[model samples]
Target: MFSSHSKLYRHASPGVQEELLALTSRLRSVITAQGVVRRTTAAIERSQWLAPAEWSALQLEAMRALALHAGRRVPYYREMFARLGIDPRRWRSLDDLTEIPVLTKDEVIAAGERLLAEGGPWLRFKGSTSGTTGRAMAGWRDRASIAFEQAFVERQARWAGYRRGERRAWLRGDPVVPSRQADGTLWRMNRAENMLMLSSYHLTPQNGAGYIEALEKFDPVMIQAYPSSVGYLARWLEEHDRNYRGKSLRGIVTSSETLGEAERRIIARRFGCPVFDWYGAFERVAAIGTCEHGHYHVMEDYGRVEFETNGDGTANLIATGFGNRVMPFLRYRADDRVVLADPGFACPCGRSFRVVERVLGRVDDAIRTPDGRHVVMLDWIFSGLFGLVEAQVVQERLDEVCIRIVAGPEFGHREEQALLLRARDRLGAQVIVRIERVAQIARTRNGKFRQIVSRLSGSNETDV
Candidate 1:
């Protein structure tokens, strides 16, 4: 399937390439959409009608199957299991999974090819993290795993009253529009997906009205956006006393960041729709989505999630993905902190998926450029920095920005120049870019690291 699509795309003209790409995207979406509907329907039925003990038994069965598969097929897991004195045959229950040590990002990076499954006839798709938390990791996913994730996402959208085939507006980190094109139409239509893709990097207070106008004209049934971008729009609407109440919008789906209470409320109030937030990563290790009842529910069928409780009443999320047989992530420490909801607590919507009180990671300020552009998720600026231990972007003023880097032995003038060039490319050349080599970058009082810190007035730190 991949080869056929690649051939068609390769032979197409530039104008035809866009259409072919959209066609392929839509084709994949259609295939995944079928699985999504089927799996989500079954999941809803099981969560709503099945007994708690029965649901738990199903999860346990799935976990055991995944663990045994990992032990037999994945080299890293097989060796780790043997070294830890764990017999895969005896791994009958979720409790036995603890015998395997938590898989850290560092461990995954170091393990390299050893973590991939052997004797795989399945196709693998390469994916990587955004490195927003200073630790970038890459991995592969099988087709089934990708389908399962899409199913979970579709289920979340359904929970928020969005039906399939609805027109939607998307404002995420994807560079769908050319950064240099500063004229008309800040958004492009993806006719195949029925989506209007807006540029996240182009949103500013001065240009926000243009975005709102585009959204209003698009008349989408839903908007899937990064929390920070939607929050900024909501803030603009509130300050200007403008409302988007009469649009076709039914709900807003936010992902790739922590949605704060304030941001959620503001977005919900301004858009006159429910805000559904999702938490997951490219690792496919875990997934948590918001329900209509305003609760975050962890999808147990997608992954086996374990919580490591901290002294401050928060817990670090560790997950084991079941569908990715090509590269199984067993007990992978996601490094995301979450406040675990009480086990006895139940949502009004009555889904049996476990609840997460909140995701407590990735809070950062939007970098305001000299041209009044607000840029979130600045980690992309430091991409391809091989020996960068950690980096932070701090905006002291609208025109002045400082980047602090903790470099390893391999980092030098060349890598520094690359980083500077990227930064200048994103922000205009007029903005002062100072690169400082530092021993370490400081964390917040809560010991969490932020990638972007803006000291500009009214630029509140937001997640994702």
Candidate 2:
């Protein structure tokens, strides 16, 4: 669903808005109802029972098809293949994929439209990456690929005992409720999916009680949210000597940010359910989902994943998605790291998917407020921002936030003001936002870019 911050949704009466959302959900469900998502989900469910040889066979087939498609239709891959004197169409095994150089973010941007398939429907789905590294790239996928990924998401929810149309609550980045809703109704009902959409941006200590009350009343069978947003609710519960009393709640599914152990334990304990952490990126190359046995299983069926040793006790994620063909992501390297399990390690759940100890994904620090509200996911301020190569938020003090930006060609005073206004919407008027122009944002010692940096040393901010 699009953001509720839009003027059309903002002015509608609550009942009318609910009806509109349900209508939107109805239109969207046509993609899944008696359609591609259902068939794909059923096929993947069967794939889980496949032997290692069977799984590899299916993967190789998908890989081979993608290779041939890219070689013929995509100018970028075709030229690269010609330059290397390699014919992907004649390739035999997965090793051949390695012969093609790994694709980097910069290469994708430089190549631009040359990477898209030659036919029509050039870019039905397109969006900007969060650019946590400050080099946000435009990404595109075919409609079929988007529906295929949804099946996998549905399968993950089913792992947590979710059923279609079951009541669920979302506390992720969706701005279902306006940031400045004075009434403290921080949620909206979407009857089409029987979901309660909660606003992550407006969650603060002052309105924590109302959010919890709304959630309890909804009594969702599953709670899908970002770790940061849900962490705030969990900490608020513990601090106030309370626990979530949703009898119907099955489990909490968290994504986007890394789920810290401290946050996970408290969230599970206070919410009276296990916390299932999921990992996926805007690039749609790699995927990791938590299983019934609490093991982090690489979703091998979703995409082909490889680990490049980072030499710091972790490995970088390199993947090639099998679903997308409009812009095939063959050997795309991501800025994420994961901890692999010991060799021969297996899960009790009877799945043969390779297991990982954990994903050391984004560990962005939250920006603390003067009024005790620690605002996480400040990168949302840069969402859809153009003329900006990179951006970082640095908190020097509780009351002031400095936005450091690497300006793009279109970045100017107006763009900076838009950035400031977005920050103010989340940080509130009490906090001062200052934009600082920089030639480039420096990466950490390990050559990793951080979206947010807090100079408050040894800050013992609460569990949230």
Estimate TM-scores for all models.
Answer: 0.88, 0.94
- Mind giving the per-residue lDDT tens digits that candidate 2 earns over 1-464? 43365677767777767777777777766643347677888889998767777877777888888888898999999998889887766667777778888998889888888988889564477777755586657777766887888988888898888998899999987666655564457778898888998888776788899989999988999999999889999999999999998899998999989988888899999999988889988888988999987889988889888889867668888898887888888899987889988759878888888888989887777888765667777666786776788888888888898988898788788878888888888787778999999988887775667788887865532221
After superposition, candidate 1 runs with Cα above 4 Å error: 1-24, 27-49, 130-132, 383-385, 409-418, 457-464
Candidate 2: residue 180 Cα off by (Å): 1.9
lDDT digits (tens) for residues 1-464 of candidate 1: 32212545435444554575477677776545366457756875465445667667776787778777888988898887788877756766678778888888888888977988898655677655545567456688766667777777777787777887889889987655555556466666777778887878777778889999899988999899999898889999999998875468888999987789999999999999999998887788888888888898887767789889987778888898766788888888886888888989988876777888998766677788766777877766766575787888899889989998889888889989988977876776667899998998887776777888888888876433
Candidate 2 local accuracy as lDDT? 0.82
Identify the runs in model 2 with alpha carbons over 4 angstroms from their true place.
30-34, 120-123, 457-464
What shift in Å separates residue 13 of candidate 1 from its native position after superposition? 13
Angstrom error of the Cα, residue 112, model 1: value is 1.6
- TM-score computed on alpha carbons, candidate 2: 0.94
